[model samples]
Target: MKYLVIGGAGFLGSHLINSLDGEITIVDDLSTVKYFEKKPGINFIRQKIENFETNEKYDYVIDLAARPSPEDYINHPVETALSNSIGTYKALEIARKSDAIFFYTSSSEIYGHAEIIPTPETYWGKVNPNGIRSCYDESKRFSEALIMSYLRQYGLDVRIQRPFNVYGPKLREDGSYGRVISRFIYQALKGEDITIFGDGNQTRAFLYVSDWVEATKKMLGKGLKGTILNIGSDKEMKIIELANTILSMTKSESKIKFLPPREDDPPRRAADISKAKKILNWEPKVNIEEGLKITIEWFKGVLN
Candidate 1:
């Protein structure tokens, strides 16, 4: 299969690229550093997704391009907005022209402060378009809307997967990019205080990268056009509990520090994966403990 993986150099993108075998072309600007080595036989192009130009036909056009780091989008909201808006348009145009199946990695952040627990694909999200996180949230929402428009207006085959708190190796462990799992692991390993932005009661369900990758491949192979699946673990954990777990796992003496909550941070986030189970016969197999153990080992290698 010929695949065009935009943002294939990022954490999740790198893992996905390594899993596939075939003619693959990757386009990334190195805005986020790639932790894995680029494999042989893969074509690499360094460019912004919005400015990317390609005429080659592809069987799959997957757009994983986006500045998902809260610090990143907050710091560079305009670029983040443009990446999903114009960048998504660019991806759609390519898929439409090549008649390739289009896949987009939409985040669970789209369901900002969801009123429902284990939010489903049907939830029309209670998102704030003007909030600090709006750049990433609204842009993803817009990208999904734009994809749907393409599906109806141009008959483009598309799959939109909303992943919740996917964490694993290669996830950046610096600044704002060091999301909860990676950040906690890094801090704990280095004997630094593990910072909790809120009261430590905010909950999140994290899916291991491998489990998410499996679901993604299933979604692609199923070729379900116009399908929106929530690919995430239904298991949940509190922020405080997560910190404690990481500390114990890493055997570090990092104290847990609670700070003022970040504005627009979701209090609770999980996924209702019934749709994924029924449609793709898929559900996350990695429990939090197991996933954390594997992830901690990877962080150790990176640190050492």
Candidate 2:
């Protein structure tokens, strides 16, 4: 198998590359990665998506490259938006020409404020167009539009997976861009206070990296053909409860610090996985407790 990962050096791409049974090829700018390390079967080239020109054909093209950090968007909005939009356009072009299976990693952020609990695939999301995080969220939403357009017009095989709060190894925790998992876990390990951007009641489902990668593979293989799926765990946890869980799991002395609610953060986030389960026969096997153990181990190695 021949596979091409656009952001192959980043968190999700690195893990996915490790699991794929293929001659893996990677194109990425490892400038932002402070803790990135190379792994096996990966032919990596330090390159950006805009200048990434390759004649090599691939059987699969998985695009995990994008500026997914809120800090990036705030500091360098232009560059962030470019990486999200133009970068995706180039990768989809490659997938189209090669007739390869295209897998795009979308986010659960698109579902801004759910109209119902456990949002199904058919539910139209409620997003603020002019919000602060719109650069990241809207760019991803536009990327999805591009993929669907290609699939519809050119008959390309494209798979979309919207994963929620994925956390594990290779996370960027230099206080740059990441969800609560990496930063909170690091602080909890060090006995620092955990900061919540919104009220402590905002709920989210954190999927382990392993589950996310497996679901991506499955979706690439069998869930395409114009099927958009939400890949997330249904186990919801409050922001405060999540902090407490990390504190308990790591045996840390970190205290929860509440702050004013941030703009556009939904009160609760939970996915309706009936479509994913019925279609791909995929469900999260690892619970949060087990996932945290694995994640804490990784964080310990990083901190040490």
Candidate 3:
């Protein structure tokens, strides 16, 4: 099927683009983007989704476009919200018009600090609307609503996956956008101090890129009509424990230091992925350690 990947130039998007077979179109602007290089063979469109006017459409549209980093959003909240809300709406509109399958990438950030350990899709989030990171969390919440509305009103084929802590190759060093996994991996490889934000008790389930993509692609082809399934590993770890695991694995000389946690930092997060597994029949294959080894080598090449 013909596919269009929004924001296909960056890290996660690039990997997703690479994994696709058959004809694919990429919509992105490489302006001020400092991570992955512009890939080959992708039909790259150089325009912001806001100003973007495409005569083309697709059989499937995967919306991976968003300013994902909390730090980036803090500085540019307006653009952050706009990118997510408007960009997702446009993608949904295209899907509705084309009668295409639409997959929307939401986040575990939508779960915020969960009142529960492993957050089920039904668990209402604990996000602060007034918090500094609200730009992303709330914007994605708005995006979810918008996409679901299309699914209800127009019966546009739609599925939403909320990925947790996805990390792999082509990571950007811009600090805000990359996950804790990429940040720690890069710092350890660079012989730099590993900074753990806060006292390090905050937890997240880290899903390797391959595992994430595998789960995602499977769910995108299923009976989950207008459903929100989280695509992530069920493995859980604290910030400090995760840091130590990396240090132990790499045998690096980098010191693990502490910083005060940022606002809206979740106390703990994990996916109660029973839905994705039972429904989609997909589970994460790569364990954390194996995933880290692969990621570390990728960073070594780029940093060297």
Candidate 4:
């Protein structure tokens, strides 16, 4: 099988590429990650997804392109928005023409400060269109709509997955672009203060990369077209608890520092993964402790 992965250098995209087996082609602008070295049966095209052009039809065309981190998106709002909107359109068009199965990696951010505790795919979501995070959130929502439209009008085979707080090895561990788990792990490992933006009561469900990849492959293998599923752990934990756990696990002397919350930061997030279980027969296997231990070990290597 031949596959096309856009943003193949980013955290989730790179992991997904490694998980797949086939002749794989990667398109990335290298804005967030370095271009990987050439390898057999793998081709890397260093370009923005919006500008990617090809006549080769693929069995799978996955779009994981976007400024996924809040700090990154807020800094490059236009790029983030366009990456999902126009870039997604380009990918969908390719899928439409080639009759390829298109997979869109949406986000749990579309749920905003969700009214539902464990937000289901059926929930319409309560999002602030003009909020700081809307660039990433609303654009993702738009991409979902675009994909559905194509599915409805042009009969494009499309699958959508909303990943909630996916973290593991290879996650960004630098600057403001890093996710909470990686950032906390990095700080704890380095004996720096683990900063908590809000009151530390905000909650999130973390899914390890391996678990996420496994579920994704299962979903793809099932060939469920025009389906939206949540890929994440239902095991929820508060931000403070996560930081404390990382500190304990790392045996670091780092102390937790509380700061004012950033604008539009969700108070809580957890995925109702029943749809994924029912449709794909998939659920996350790695528990939080095991996932964090593995992640902390990986970050130790990177930091050292």
Candidate 5:
């Protein structure tokens, strides 16, 4: 099988590429990645998905290009919006022509401040269209709509996967753009203040990257077209508890610093993975503590 992977140089894409056994081509501008070592026996194109032009045919077209970091999207909203809206269109066009199965990696952030505890794919979501995080949230929502339209109108084989708070090795930990787990681990390792926004009661369900990659490969391998799956761990965790865990694991002497709540930050976020379990017959295997231990070791290697 042949595959075209957009944004295949980032954290999730890098791991996904390692699991594939076929001719592969990765097209990415490297805007969100800091350091990605190119793998052998694959074609790499250094360009944005929106502007990339390709006539090659493939069996699969996977679009994972987007600025997901709250800090980065909030800072560069226009780029984020275009990456999903226009970028998704370009990927769809490629899949349409190549007659390939298309897979889009959407986010759980589409459910902004969700009223439901474990959000299912049936939920329409209550996202803010004009908020600070809308660039990332609304754009993902729009991309899902666009992908559905392509499936309905053009008979394109398409699949959508919404992933909750995924983190592990190769996750960005350089600065403010890092997600909660990466940021906390980096702070703990550096002996800096572990900052918590709001009252530290906000909760999130995190899936380790390896488990996520396993589910993704299964979805692409066996999932039918027009199917949407929510891939994540159901285990929920509080921010304060997460901070304490990281501090304890790293044995760092960093105090917890409380800050004002972030704009449009969700009070609680978790996934209802019943559909994924029934359809893909998969569930996350790694618990939070074990996942964190491995992640911390990866960060320590980078530090050394």
Candidate 6:
């Protein structure tokens, strides 16, 4: 099948492209990632998705383009907002015109400091509209609304997936924008102090990228039109525990250091994947330990 993957050079997008086997075209601005080796069956276009104009039709259009990390969003809020809002609109329009199945990769941050623990898709979410994170969070919420509107007005076949903290190979392992797992692994590999932004009490459910790709492929194959599902592992752990796990796995002398928390950082995040289980017959197979081992190996290679 032919596919259009916007932001296909980013962490999750790159993994998705690598996992797919058909004709695929990747449109990206290369904001976060600059260089990707060209491979057969994948066409790479180095352009912003908002400006991407294509009359060619595809069977699937996957929108994964956005500044997803909290630090990254706060730094480039305008770009983040535009990519999710305008870029999303452009992607949805492409899907509508092509009569293709559209898939949007939303975020767990949409459920900001959710009152519900393992947040379900039904939760309306408690988000600060004017907060630092609102750019990323609100944009995602707005994008979902846009998708639903198209589905209602134009009968567009669209699917939305809210992925919780996903980590594995190709995850940005640099600066403040890096994800928790990758950052911890990077510090441990470098024998530097592993920094925890809060009191190390915040919890997050981490899903390996491979498992996320598997579930995404299943959802695409199922053609679950107009469905919103959470794609994440149900296993939850504290930030301190995750740090300790990384230190143990890497056998590093890195100590855990707690710092002041960032603004609007959620205290806990877990996904209620019951909907995905019942609807797509999918569940994350790699546990935290196994996932970490693989990630640690990749980080080691990068560091060396």
TM-score of each: 0.98, 0.95, 0.95, 0.97, 0.98, 0.98
Q: What ranges in model 3 sit over 4 Å off?
A: 35-40
- Model 5 is weakest, by summed lDDT over 10 consecutive residues, at 171-180
Candidate 3: minimum summed lDDT over ten consecutive residues — where? 30-39
Worst 10 residues of 2 by lDDT: 31-40
RMSD of 3: 1.6
Model 4 over residues 1-304: C-alpha lDDT tens digits?
A: 8899998878888788877889899999988773244566789899998898899999899888988888888999999999999999999988888889999899998889899889899999888998899899999999999999999999888999999999988888788678899889988988889999988999999999999999888868756888899899777799999998998899999989998899989898999999889988788888999999998887778679
- In order, candidate lDDTs are 0.91, 0.83, 0.81, 0.88, 0.93, 0.90
Best lDDT among the predictions, by candidate number: 5
Candidate 4's C-alpha runs over 4 A off are 34-38
Quick one: how many clashes does candidate 5 have? Answer: 0
Q: How high a TM-score does candidate 3 get?
A: 0.95
User: For residues 1-304, what per-residue lDDT tens digits would candidate 6 score against the true structure?
Assistant: 8899999988888788878878999998888883355677688899999999999999999999988777888999999899989999999999999999999999999999999889999999999999999999999999999999999999999999999999998898788578888889989989889999989989999999899999899889765888899999777799999999999999999998888999999999999999999998899999999999998888788679
lDDT of 4 at 125: 88
lDDT assessment of candidate 5? 0.93
lDDT of 5 at 45: 97
Candidate 5 ranges with C-alpha deviation above 4 Å: none
What C-alpha lDDT, on a 0 to 100 scale, does residue 276 get in candidate 5?
89
Across 218-262, the per-residue lDDT of candidate 5 in tens digits comes to 888754889999999777899999999999999999999999999
What's the lDDT for candidate 6?
A: 0.90
